[model samples]
Target chain A: MTEASDTLVEEVQARFDDLTILEYEFDNVEIELARKANALNAPLYKRRAEVIAKIPHFWALVFGRAPPEVETYIQPSDEKAFALYLDTFEVIHFEIDDPKGSPRSFSLKFGFKENEYFKDKVLEKKFWFRKTSDWEGLVSEPVKIHWKKGQDMTFGLTDAAYALAQAKKRLPPGNTDKSKERALPEYKALADKIEESEESSASFFALFGFVSSWRYVSAEESGKIRQTEAENLAKVKRGELVEEPDSDEDNENDEDDDHDYQETEVFPGGDEVAILIAEDMWPSAIKYYKRNHDDDDSDDDDMDDVSVNDRANENDDDSDEELDIRALVNKGRKEPTSNSPPMPPPARKKQRKA
Target chain B: MTEASDTLVEEVQARFDDLTILEYEFDNVEIELARKANALNAPLYKRRAEVIAKIPHFWALVFGRAPPEVETYIQPSDEKAFALYLDTFEVIHFEIDDPKGSPRSFSLKFGFKENEYFKDKVLEKKFWFRKTSDWEGLVSEPVKIHWKKGQDMTFGLTDAAYALAQAKKRLPPGNTDKSKERALPEYKALADKIEESEESSASFFALFGFVSSWRYVSAEESGKIRQTEAENLAKVKRGELVEEPDSDEDNENDEDDDHDYQETEVFPGGDEVAILIAEDMWPSAIKYYKRNHDDDDSDDDDMDDVSVNDRANENDDDSDEELDIRALVNKGRKEPTSNSPPMPPPARKKQRKA
Candidate 1:
């Protein structure tokens, strides 16, 4: 073995003697730990119970077999139940709410057998808590689930589940109806009015072209940069969309007017072309422009254009971050019909859907 | 107290009994006990030891002082310690590959202390494992971590640290070809198509418009309809595009003009006006279209024309779904150099800056 391998083995031998994975006496202890730590701003996300309590129809997936532990609060008759069982485990980890005074989060995750005939079926439960729990309830509702044998969905949910648990346990209000409405543009427009708007940078054109993809630029996605036209310009001036454009169109042929993202017979007017061109290459185009477009100090251009857009997205994620079960327990759902968009970071979850 | 109160009290009293949690023994056996009854297919996850190895920083955040556990890999002298710490957590939680046969996920989640000293600290660690470990190596690299709390960063890695204890991980292949250029539009001429092409279900246009908050509609958006546009007639004559117009514009518009969404704003010039307008009312608009417009027959023709735009950016809360770990891990980085657009349901994460 190489020297590194030898050293690694030695280190491994040493650690085996020192480290031990601690399991809490009960999942509730994790909640207690989180409450103590979150007062100082710690990360405490432990799935208090292994599953989501409300899954309208869990047994249907498994056909006639429902795991034993899956008690019927309301089991649909068509679905199958393997058995009734309440297997429990101690959760030791916690998600930090603040991150400062809190130590580290550790919780116990346990699985309850839900159905055997459906194969190795069980209701998975994770117990998580955070410092925010001190003010309200301690543990989050059980997030119950059913998955195929060897097809656990936790990979997508583990971090996301806890992130949300902790955030909900920690952060305050941000997502609102007004905010949701402006999330797309009004509240998020990068707010960079180029003062010299005289000569646009190559990046500006690049970004504009990129956004065109969303608009549907079909003719030349490969290598051609279609030239912008006059009628399209007037429409743009009037705030009308034209067509989706390709980036590689040669500028030399601008006067020839035959070459444009919408130049072909596809569109009847210039407005439709711009829309296609605009949406396709935006994010990258925006990045490039933000990197190079600020030469002539524009109006209120202090904030990076990309940053503004990013901030909006980040703020949106924040809602994902603050979905604390502690808070949920403290406050009853106000608007039953409307659900808040989760502010994530704290809310990033492992989803099987993706 | 009422019976409900008595039950609550009994539950609380039982909880106070300090029952052991996860490690609860069944017949004095150390192995996990099967709940009293039944079975169904449900998976469980456990974090690899290596993930726990780098959590010193997480511990530090809660305690206001990192545990000796973290010191070996991240020293006070290393400014990258915080970054490294978060990176470790992010890497382990979000990137661990989903191998075939191993579907459940394991991640460590912990609790925070409720004090001021360790503000923003990490209290506990929850280890989550996913079902895809079998496929990790095919898509991603093995994580390299310094195991010994006292190990020197400048020194080489130890074998123990690189053991199979590491979770196999994968990076979603978001095709990125930087050398490729964006397509720019022939902005000026795209306007004509706005006036001539087909139009979509008015509701789709309205919803898209509302969501994007397109204060006003431009002809470009209005240029094409799902059915047929006059320009397509010309295109068919020229054999430019494949499908011919289903019917002439005047003929189709005769019966469908009423299909415009309730919220669209016609552009100044009749030339270009946006038609697909589903926004804040997306769910409703689609529902309405599905039930009223199509019912069964006419729906097929207009379905393609419904332009439902993702007007509002959905920030994933990591709500156990639609997660992007790379973004979550490198959240501290000013910007992550990612190339793919965020996906629906679960998001594709931003990549490391090369």
Candidate 2:
């Protein structure tokens, strides 16, 4: 190694420190921008919720036309459930104004009518902005879904995961090692169940039971960790402490990977799925709903432009279009001509004949 | 298709319109945030420029340690030129305050000492925020390089591209059709040159002569296009105009592809490269410079922990580390012990012997 001039090294370090400070300022500006945007969006979102309430199956149609990122996770059974019972949907930036919390923390609330699928009137999943030893982002716990009888859309996967999580919670403090926890009957049952099922067959309802691939930390724990990190950073800045190197931590991470049940097996890319739903699908609900109308107009225009006049040709075109989820959901579903559909589980006429 | 309830459709459209308005507000918030961040960053950047100037070969070392996204574009000769002649670097968000302009518009300004490479003291390449029929982004013209005889790093490629661009500029307004333009002598010469050369071996200096793959529009033209679009949108909102269908536009794009000299043939992903440099590299220069030092300390620590002691073993380790750009740049090169190196092109002792 070459000998670096002491003063030159200090100069470079000083510049690096200044750049770090500038980054801190930029982060503050982003947080401020989020707070301001949220204030302006609140009233408009409230108005939208009221307007969308009067339109029957509005959310259903929106989900039908959802972007592939979200649609890829929805099973055939999930679509049926959505068409039958899904109602008002909302996303709340719950920590936008909390000084100690991040704007990234948000809640996806889904209101549903009394359906045979689940007992909860409102299934709300919250993603808390979290930072751990080597990872940082939004993390969530499995939301319990009370399914009636044999009506579990996710088959028995969600049920098993939820039961295992409960059993783990009951373990005594300081005795919750990974091997010990896995030995529990509930954990063994869930593991065996997961081993037997094909991940591709899992329903979108499995998302309700999705937890982080890494260790799940509560919001309170995340906040405390952040505070401790801040303190440690300040100490280093003041030259009162030296940062510890995690040279052997890689081995521990590898061990964790060996036994960990990655959330992807059940709900592939669950974090990204939840994020897309909250950030895009929820905010642009109306856009997706209106997109179906545009698609229908374009399809008809293409057929006419191509001079498809035969009845048999038209029937073939209809069959091809039926493969699109939007077509299946809106096939013969009549818009509410008189009063809106009842708040309770009104029998939704099956629109998909195919 | 089933008949859509008129009032219900109207209700959905109205909500969509409201959401669009909210999006407009959100866009305004983002612009305001940029303005504020720029105001804060301006002074810090100025301080950085001054501090970096005092450290000789500062930008050179930083470029040597550039992230892979930037490093992949830089040829071996580019590194030699940077080590010998590149002095200071600055990125300017030139359109941050322009009412009709976008903050995305930025300039990559390189300050170079008098060298055998090019005549320019300051090579300023500006990317104007532009919009065309099917694209919106920062677009730039081929910046002419006044290169010394027999010293053209891009091997006459930049010369050919610059000549063709200049010739195209002189074409009559309506006669600038692509097919006819491609038949021009300068264009034919450039086409032949590109056909013969391996893009992988092209010098990074070609970035100076890069143009957008899409039709390049000046900021003035972009502002006019935006104004017209806004007016058309207003008319549509007021029920005074019907939006035209763009069913044939796709076919026109295919036609454009036939004769267009896609910039990727010269510089693959030039747009993304410029964006990442301006947005990531420029703002985080100090971080990259310091990262090399951290890498060195870690490497040494690993050697000690693994009990590497033999002198021949140490020699082998040094040979393996030679491939690292940081090692090549810093190898046995004594830091400025007395005065910083001169501003002009000083003879930098060649550090890469491998």
Candidate 3:
């Protein structure tokens, strides 16, 4: 309505008219997660409402991001089980717990689907933005918000939340204890999925799953450390990980060497002594037991490595969003080089065995 | 025919016509345990090749059964799984180290259908039988087999022995493993109608899929145990578990009147630790926890007085089968009635989490 503002808007639109908005990072993850938490709660009784509330918060701690809004939820009307719609989101937002909080962050997670899962999954997007920075101006720009429909199987506080929500929707909410009678497959499937993801990665974050305290190593440092490993393995073959340096009588040059079977100061933090491991472990000893026995052998080492990396990513994502069941199943699948087992999405979240 | 031969025929039928067939033993339970021994080889491959060999002998160890005339086995194949049927045959003519070699075994196994599943399953039969002392007579009986048309969800196995004479015209001999793999499910469905009779009592034997090493309470013990429980609960509430005996000094009844919680054990097998136990832990807890949550004056009872006998028969019929997928979402499912969590069947036999 103001002449000055209209004039400014016209100028900006004219300049960026040719710019195409292909991707958008919406702080929708929170909304989406809450939506699912709400959906699963539909079948639960009011007294069991705590189950629904506890689920997402617990997952937000584990998964890294809370995306996927429920498209639909099918509950059996019992305390046993039901189904959920799962759509892993691209944009992730973490509430900035600072004094000047008026809507905080929106960060685009950069990772691509291998094939046609999305048109430009791997193509980078400028995700990070602060709501305070001309946030209204950015909204005017054409942007693409990622959306899809899918299904998942999960359990826990979410299951309780889900049951409670349903119960509240149908009846009235007070104190619900129906959570104790939580469904079977949902709870079990959730446990199974978490373990599977970790099985693939064994990241310090994944380790935090069973043991509260955990250790973490930076992703980049992990790679550098491994490069040193190959060097050490070669040297050991030639008699070298430990060598007598010219500087001393001791087997020196140790300071120049990197750590082996590396450890991290940070891990899935639960106050336990759990250690964050590298992604490479998936293709190695953790899954090596099966590959060594397999009649098939090839040069595609990348496939095995995904199992490890995915696990860590899963944990990292937990700190940012809700868990993704399909992605979790994909973590434990046999290396794709060997016909990867059935679409892992059928599996729940991956976790370590207790 | 000589007159003397007529007398001999009578003797032969008396000895061979009737057979003492032993199926399963109710006294013992067979829990299929997954072995985590990396040094050992999985028999899955060998069993796959011998399409008509005997079922694996592991069932005997699982059920703690004496080796009968036959055994049951489970084998996963290249594309599917096959539950094998085998016989403990006695071949009298064979000899090895000694002149009296206990008739060696000669097993025969075959595949059949279990459901409407097609590509979801594959079928083949393998046997592992012991040699017999009455081989000539056993060979005299011919097996008659048939596969009713239309319905494609069942099958059976019968041998040319035990006086089933002149029945070999129904089916053809088995072929190679590859052929069986190709024919499976389809042929299995075709053969679904081959059972001789459906006996209701025998269904229980079939319902609990055979695995090796489970320990179930003996039927006699199970019944008595349930009955004892019913009486105990009633007595507990009345505070009348002990009765006053006449002609006794005041000191005489004190020891016996304290409580029966310290007396005989009630669990399936925790005889040495005769601790007090509720008839069922979970349900009882649910009832008690909910009811007494408001009552603060009930008792200042010790935790030791809390019972651990809850999980006993809650899942007696179900084998307490919990689905274990590869996730960490909801791993530790507590068994309320019992102190210990319910143990799930192994995920993968050789790679079980210990």
- DockQ, per-model, please? 0.01, 0.13, 0.01
- Candidates in descending lDDT order: 2, 1, 3
CA lDDT scores, all candidates in order: 0.24, 0.62, 0.22
Model 1 TM-score, 2 decimals: 0.14
Best by TM-score: 2
Worst 10 residues of 3 chain A by lDDT: A133-142
> Model 3 captures what fraction of native contacts?
0.00
User: Who is ahead in lDDT, 1 or 3?
Assistant: 1
The digit string of per-residue lDDT tens for model 1 on A112-175 reads 4554322333323322212210011112222323334643322222222223333332333422
Name the regions of candidate 1 deviating beyond 4 angstroms: A1-136, A139-354, B1-154, B160-336, B340-354
Once fitted onto the true fold, the runs of candidate 3 whose alpha carbons sit more than 4 angstroms away are A1-354, B1-166, B169-196, B200-354
Chain A TM-scores for all candidates read 0.18, 0.78, 0.18
Q: What does candidate 2 score in Cα RMSD to the true structure?
A: 9.1
Ranking by TM-score: 2, 3, 1
| Candidate 3 per-residue lDDT over residues A1-354, each given as its tens digit | 246534443332222111101001112232333343333322332312232232212221122221111101112211011111121213322333322221222323333333212233432222111121001101111122232222112212223323332433353332222333233344344444444444332322121122111111222333343344335334534432223123221112122223321121111321211111111221111122222211111222222222211222222222211123233323434542321111110101112110
**Largest lDDT belongs to which candidate?**
2
* Displacement of the residue A70 alpha carbon in candidate 1, Å: 34
